[model samples]
Target: MSIPAEKVRERLHALRSRMEKKHIQTVILWDPDNQYYFSGFKAISYSRPIVYWIYEQQTAYIIPELEDLHAEENAYTDSFHVYHERYNKGSNDTSFLDPFIRLLQNLPSDTRIGVEYEVMPAYVYQAVLDHGHDVVDIGEDIIDLRSVKDEEEIKWLDEAGRLSDVALDASFRHLKTGMSELEFDSYGDQAFLQAASEKYPEVVVGYENWTCSGIRRSAMPHLHSSTRTFESGDPVVHSRQVWINGYRAENERTFLFKDQATEEQKKLLKLAVDAQQAGMQAVKPGVRACDVDLAAYEVIKEAGFEDYIDHRIGHGLGLSEHEEPYLRFDNERILKEGMVYTIEPGIYVPGVGGFRHSDTVIVTADGSRSITHYPRSYEEMLIE
Candidate 1:
């Protein structure tokens, strides 16, 4: 197994402890990430609906027939209740829900079950209810647990951060006029894939990139890379998220082409850089999550461009692209040691375009250290 057996046991122990405290006899995990967290098995796709069930004494998984061998090899579960699809496997449970419902019906009527309220499908939830067992939410407990990164998770984050910088360096090296957004992204993808293959051999590594160039396109926060070619004087928002061993590190930079960028555009970009610095500086243990957001927001507010700000300063980053305990204005959650976050403060001006630089940071015992170290300065970002 990629994850140490002891590490998986530690995680299961932690969750089971929470379950015991809440009198939850069983926990049904619906989210793929959550399932992979407890069991070391992560399928390429979840269209078959893999479900993880955690009980006091043991753990189990409900998966399709095709994944039976994969689960046996990777999953740390004690048992697997597989549903078949092929006609030759007749008389066996034909659908995922068939085994799921059977399991629910077998549970004691008075048993209290735990489930992810937000992600569990309505029909699946109703089936649990139909079984006459009491249900409670365990999503918050899992989120709380995952917010703090373990040493092993942190190690992978560090590697992911390093790989992200490598990809960004390659992308920036190839930056020039007339390159399509998709073409720009291809340079980084190829570079990253080559590097990962050379270094890690059989390790799982992947990335996602989106390049928004020009005034109108860059103004929008999230957009897929397209065939649109870059023009001179355009503000470009290049975002890249790299993952190694399922741990992700987000690195983004907004750069301006050396062609007719207005004075206002220069100021906005600088403001964004300054705001990101403040946000990064404010990330430390024992501080409120909102404080980090406000530190960055105050920078933008002082510059009278607060209206251009739309999203929060950042969010937690780990096994998932975006995690919980986000750095938002209203979130009062205390930042803890070992927690990972992305410090991304952005401004989207209608005419000036978007300016934001994101860096993944890990909260240390005293302060935090950024993992992504790509050149984000305005001078360096100006592609000549």
Candidate 2:
């Protein structure tokens, strides 16, 4: 189960308490992430919108009839309102509005429905308005609720971290001087899928793995895997996504060839690693997200290479690889316990190359704990 029954019940109770306090009659959840967060089921349909309705004391699902069986089998809901229609013989029918209308008509009109306005389609919004129902936009409220993870989410994230570590280890082991960039990424991709299978057995790895080598690698933050061969003196950057129980963890690393890093390269790597450490150390309850960015920025600036430091230190990692509570220089969101994010500080020198060190970290009541365990020191990257 993505989320156990007991945990789901607890979350439902909490949500109910909040709803009652706000006097919200019902919450119409359309965001897939929110759906997966509240219920453990992953919706498999893209043809129709997946809607979850949460009342003060009852939880229901408004899904396509085609997915009713799967939702019943996998998703935990107190009630189900399935919508489907049989097509006329030899009739061309591609729209799903009729069934959707039926589902909406069933909902109470006097109820103050809360919709995820940020993610709901304009047509859906118009439909809701046309139904003469009172609606409230609670998208930010939902995001705030999800920003602080529960104990069960933390447990799953910990497992995700371990799976990512295994994939990174496999990638590092396969890293050699003459391997093509695509070959290196292929090694990590295979390793990620194999490791995820051992844990989830049903999880599918995300789209494409990133692996870039040489000077051009510095330009692209999300480098696509390429067939270019790795040179003896080149720098390589790689990243991959691992999913376990529908939760995601992304990790990246930059490797310098053995005996090939110049004095400047070594110095820049040291500064970047030190800056990353400072940023990670700054994570704590009540600290602003930008404070963490400044912690690293101060370090890089003190080292007289502030201009070279580019990009935010890190971002929140959860169902989506990049989510809320971003760690950037201008973001003012305060950090809180149970919020997990990454601290990746890099120095990209145009002609030479770039160096970056990243790690996933969870803010604790006291300080923070780094879930990722890859070595960031220069000595750890020596090819032996």
Candidate 3:
């Protein structure tokens, strides 16, 4: 679904207020997701270097000729400057940097510009400095702005969550021995695409899936789906991230082949489920982020499986697959209502395989509720 223009206007107004407090004159958003958050435009790829400019009075985009019409149709920017590629438009700006540098020169000498320090390219950062503009890191401010979901944003996230559950159901329904990991992922891909097309015609919907099968692959946590066939007792970790209209929901499940599953494998899977539940139960407004992680960590620790833990309990989720304000042992950020997160506490044992289940959750007025609701119990995960 298209983002409401009123939402974009409200976002810009809020950002400009932040800018005024910081005494910043302009902001350059290099990250595609950040650009989308502020301007309501996102490109398929940024290989050609699309730049978004947020000024005190107006916002603008510097894009390639190919995206001139696309940006005009989707963007909420006040103006756009087209950079050309073909030889026919030689007189126009040839490179993205050409227009970017020109625009920087137009600003006042002492203009305090804001940029995303984590993602802005060094050359781009240097260009602003060379033109006598001071740059401040506004990345955190943008993260804070996006961390809380607005009513419209939450609606899209809810839709994405429902779609993810649908995809997982399709994948698990066709699970069987001998199918390749890629083949297993294909079942859900087909189901997800068909469901999205039928339910929301013309709305932007996409997904990513990876199936790590067998003990070795599943133990590693992150890997692409391979052609290796599922064995009689192979443990499989299936991950799917679904996005609709730029908002994302992550859903994952680790299942065991019941035919030849070991007792230890079953126990490990149960621990993972218990840990995830603990993490979810800990999520509420006014709770420290670290407290949530520790709540889950303590579950595995009490079971003597603390050594198997390799990652944090969860992370903030929204426009990006993984966002800031993570739920980690070191993070002390307080949880707040309207914030969305993934509660995924994982354990990877060398011989037992990895066990984890992830579900996207939104922090409610009092506690939290998971949006992706595929069955996750040990009994439900056992695939015969």
Ranking by lDDT: 3, 1, 2
Query: What is the C-alpha lDDT profile of model 2 across 127-227, one tens digit per residue?
Result: 98899988888777766777888787788778777777877887788888778887877766677677767766655445346777887784466767788
**TM-score on alpha carbons, each prediction:** 0.98, 0.88, 0.98
How high is the lDDT of residue 191 in model 3?
Answer: 91
Q: Residue 352 of candidate 3: its Cα lDDT?
A: 78
Badly placed stretches (over 4 Å) of model 2 are 83-96, 199-208, 258-261, 382-384
| Candidate 3 worst ten-residue window by lDDT | 85-94
CA error at residue 201 for candidate 3, angstroms: 1.9
Q: Judge candidate 3 against the unseen true structure and give its global Cα lDDT, from 0 to 1.
A: 0.91
lDDT of 2: 0.77
Compared with the true structure, all predictions reach lDDT values of: 0.91, 0.77, 0.91
Candidate 1, pairs of clashing residues: none
* CA RMSD, predictions in order: 1.0, 3.0, 1.0
Pick the winner on lDDT between candidates 1 and 2. 1
What is the number of backbone collisions in each predicted candidate, taken in the order shown?
0, 0, 0
lDDT of 1 at 271: 91
